[model samples]
Target: MSISRFAALALLALPLAACQPNVPQESMTDPQDATEADIARWYIGTIPDDPFDIPQVDTNLLPEEMVRQTVKYNGSEQAGTIVVDIDSRHLYLVQNNGTAVRYGIGVGKQGFSWKGAARVGRKGVWPNWSPTSTMVRIKPDLPRHVKGGLDNPLGARALYLYNGNVDTLFRIHGTNEPWSIGQAVSSGCIRMLNQDVLDLYQRVEVGAPVIVKRTGKRVVANAE
Candidate 1:
């Protein structure tokens, strides 16, 4: 069936499930005809040769648009570039074709949001996390260090952003809180689901250009 037709069907069925427990009422909006098979394939619980295991995400609780999928890319960025739209809470990895693999992201909350162009200076697997001094000041009880693991806030992987040799102290990393995807609830970093981050970690390399913008404007990355 056509995408439009499938979306229409999904809309028609939404009211019947609206009152169900743990179902988001607004999920039918921008439906992409995602099936159980798609969810299963995209969010598998195990990884080959990996010591850590991830729990399957309950996609039903998330807005349909937040689920990872290939979408038409209107941006002019070259393939392998990463574009983050803070306003939309979405991140797009540009593909060779006129398309991008979009992932739902949790952006910074209120005063914490930032916009800029940077490079992925480093990459880490199950990266250890240390809350910045500012983060510590904001939350005095927050832990200073968290070991790399399933419980770590920077879940399965991280792509550290930098400007030249200077660390921006910002990252695009996995989140332990899967339900926070597509929400503005972070401390100025881009948060992705663990499974999503694992997929991205394998595709992106260190030094990949990253553009982060808000209000529909593009920020061009500086030459390295």
Candidate 2:
């Protein structure tokens, strides 16, 4: 190898490195052993610290594990894939690197639970809430339509799921009930804290792949 060739290779590598998103690794901390400062720094790194937003999540209402954290993902899914583990009540957005941004999520109750592969068919920021006919029939008091905003059951964001061209009538959305996170509380939708959902909405685009699993499925690279 010549010095000139090595120098040329180094120069080429510099531009490639610069093109990558600057995802900080130092702030990554284990949720179990993290300090208050560690949690604060990690949270700030994962999402914007917007205190005055109308739909901001109440950190006081969130459990520690529910706070967004970037973790080592041993999964096979490529970057931008969204994996929802129903049993764990966590949604992971696979990153370009070998890691994932995990958010605490709320899944549907027993009979309402489902598992399948779908795509993010649509995205809504403070999207409107419309009770499905089935929901309206089951709960006569439910509203048919509600405008989007802080008070809406959809909260800050919603990602509508679709299997090819068919609407699944399911969503990965923000919830007004933050306390319901990490629980099986939704009629069918997968819910997140408002802030987390907003962050996720920003990262994902329409047509992104989504996998909802009932069991803890291992996503190995070769098998993916």
Candidate 3:
């Protein structure tokens, strides 16, 4: 998003925050007091004065950094520096000839597994979760739309997919169900640990191509 949008969100939220009773006086600022840096952070909901340092985890909650030593292979290692082996459920970031830094991944369940090449068309931090019309049709009571937060099924980052110029609505993103790693479990989205997604976000630029080769294709999507 543009810096203006970030500034607008910050300006919007800070006022709501300052309006709450018991907030310190110094925290309050004039309309002119908003700064570019403040806007960037609060827009991202990553305020400097956040209270929590070490995060707390619940049993039902998946730790964002969970790592599994599972096998994974995909032409991702060849996808202009990244490859995701869906069968083995691993994501690879190429560093050199025939070598890459790999991370275990979670995948779509059985019928939901997708195969084909696409590009990272969009990226979002702390993305919101809005079940598709199909998702709601499958389960009527499911929340139609939800904002971003720890409770969101999508974790800290998201990489939206596209076929040429057409949006697929599928994404490579963080998941709350880390236990689903190495398994097909999503409606169609590719999932990874939050730490892994964050790692990828830093490494991949928008428009990077992702080759999601079919299962059992020795050319890509290897279990090892």
Candidate 4:
């Protein structure tokens, strides 16, 4: 149906699945609706970055045809099993059943795609950026650290990926450059729209299971 109807249905469905095993949902209190600032701060402890400071756009921006379409969430869409389908360039937050809140995503370049399971170990809003040594070496003009704002590549939200207790340094975050949604430009992180990432950041919380697959992940229907 409509986005609101879909959201309401998903909200109704959540409580009924309480007995199932997966990530536990955090009790929401601060404004039920996920806000861009809430998500941004949740990740980096601040509001979003300014736009004028962004670096030159990457030349590897994605062409629509390159974005695949078959990425699907195959498990409990409950707070667990956040799947990013690289081949399809879509990120799915599976709650349950045959439904998932799917959003288009941007992924890594040729040798940059990574596959593994992780958790949203941490979060941020309007996050700051620091060029990895690799990015600095590759783009001599890149800054060592950037102040958060519109131009900041970190965008609206940041879901820090982790596995067990270790940080993977990869994040499913927002991009101010919305056109990059279906492209491959970053080192190995997944990117989403500022709105989409804000929406996702509100839906997800710490201790959630995140699966990133370059090809795809198999889903077990009704796993919740």
Candidate 5:
């Protein structure tokens, strides 16, 4: 309890405080003021300006809840689990302290919506996209393959879904059509803003659990 001892202890604590996560302060106070540009930025360096240079998200076009924020999570899922509330068009990444990072999302259109538990089978950055045979059948004008770029349907990152060893063909991915967020428009994959998806890509690991809930199912931790 000596003055010099206390001063030394305070000095030692400075570095730890500096190492804390750099969460945005403004978003927490009032998420209604949040915007896609105000949320986290693209972690990777910007791609060169090309014919398909990345488009900026029009915040005015988005719903207030579509932005990112940290909020209390009442669910039983442990930290690192991803819970998609299709009804609300929000995706929650459960954090360690009974909290979760919530991001607005776009769900699948009418008949394409589904509910299930799956795991992250794989991940990709600036992923190439190809219309599935089913997609091609549905939309004959859809291209067979699309190279990875800002214009690609999968914007900046993608987390592929799997049930055990089976590919579910569902993904949590960035979308070029950011205006579609908070809507039911995708075939089945979950779509996020590019910047938001990039942030999520860094946090999620392969084999992490994902729960997609279209109905009012009670959220819970992944079964062991």
Candidate 6:
């Protein structure tokens, strides 16, 4: 080929190369060697201003998909609605901008799972816990009243769900067991990471609608 022809081909290839996606650089540093400060850099960092000291989460324990992030939402639900997909183990807080803040969640196991709509009747910070009569019957040793703290089953925040004027006796709350964030092990309540629950608690308001669906459609992650 002539030199002029070769130059034209090279220019064509340059545009194609520029259009290629830029891949993120992989870290060579070992996660096991990560320091406390390094771990604190996680999106879900320790919350210092909280009434009780919230510790930084060790992200290694959580699956990458379980990490909180904003994702594309295709549902018709209005902004401020909470949609929990029990099958996908995901909770989406709908936004007005065609996106939703997604969080990993733990749902009830087996016979404990239920599906329906409810409203956030109340919000609590470091709330006290009282086992239901049914809960007491199942676990007779369970304390009727437990003061709220780090040791409490409801970690840092709780959003009490209500059906009309009646309390559903179920909740979406932070869990003392962070590792259970993506599992199906809770008795009936939806469990979230303490940091995530704190974030959710702030964005949501009393009387916000919540839909819990067993086989709901999963939200697709935004490619951009």
Stretches > 4 Å off in candidate 2: 1-52, 216-224
Per-model TM against the reference? 0.76, 0.71, 0.64, 0.63, 0.72, 0.76
Sliding window of 10 residues with minimal summed lDDT for model 6: 2-11
lDDT of 5 by residue, 68-165 (tens): 88888888988999999888889999999878999989888888887899999999878899978889899898877777765577877899999999
The per-model lDDT (C-alpha) reads 0.74, 0.70, 0.58, 0.60, 0.71, 0.74
- C-alpha-based local distance difference test score of model 2: 0.70
Residue range 40-147, candidate 4, lDDT tens digits:
222211233343222222222334332323333446446446887787677877765556777777788778789888888999867888877777788798767776
Clash count, one per candidate: 0, 1, 10, 21, 0, 0
Worst lDDT 10-window in candidate 1? 36-45
User: Compared to the true structure, candidate 2 yields what TM-score?
Assistant: 0.71
lDDT of 1 by residue, 1-224 (tens): 33234323333433343333554433222224455232232232344425666544556667788888888888889999999988888899999988899988988888888889999999998789999999999889887787887667787889999999999999999875565688777899999987788889899999899999886332322211
Q: After superposing candidate 5, which stretches have Cα over 4 Å from the reference?
A: 1-61, 216-224
- In terms of TM-score, how similar is model 3 to the real structure? 0.64
Q: For candidate 3, which ten residues in a row score worst on lDDT?
A: 50-59
In angstroms, the error of model 4 at 181 is 1.2
RMSD of 4: 15.5
Report lDDT (Cα) of residue 145, candidate 2. Answer: 82
Q: Which parts of model 6 have CA positions greater than 4 angstroms off?
A: 1-45, 216-224
| Candidate with the larger TM-score of 1 and 5 | 1
Residues 74-179, candidate 3, lDDT per residue (tens digit)? 3334534556666766666655444556666777776777878788898988888899888888889887776765456677789988898898988888754444
> What lDDT score goes with residue 182 in model 4?
64
Which pairs of residues collide in model 3?
A: 73-85, 74-85, 76-82, 76-83, 76-84, 77-83, 108-184, 108-185, 109-184, 109-185
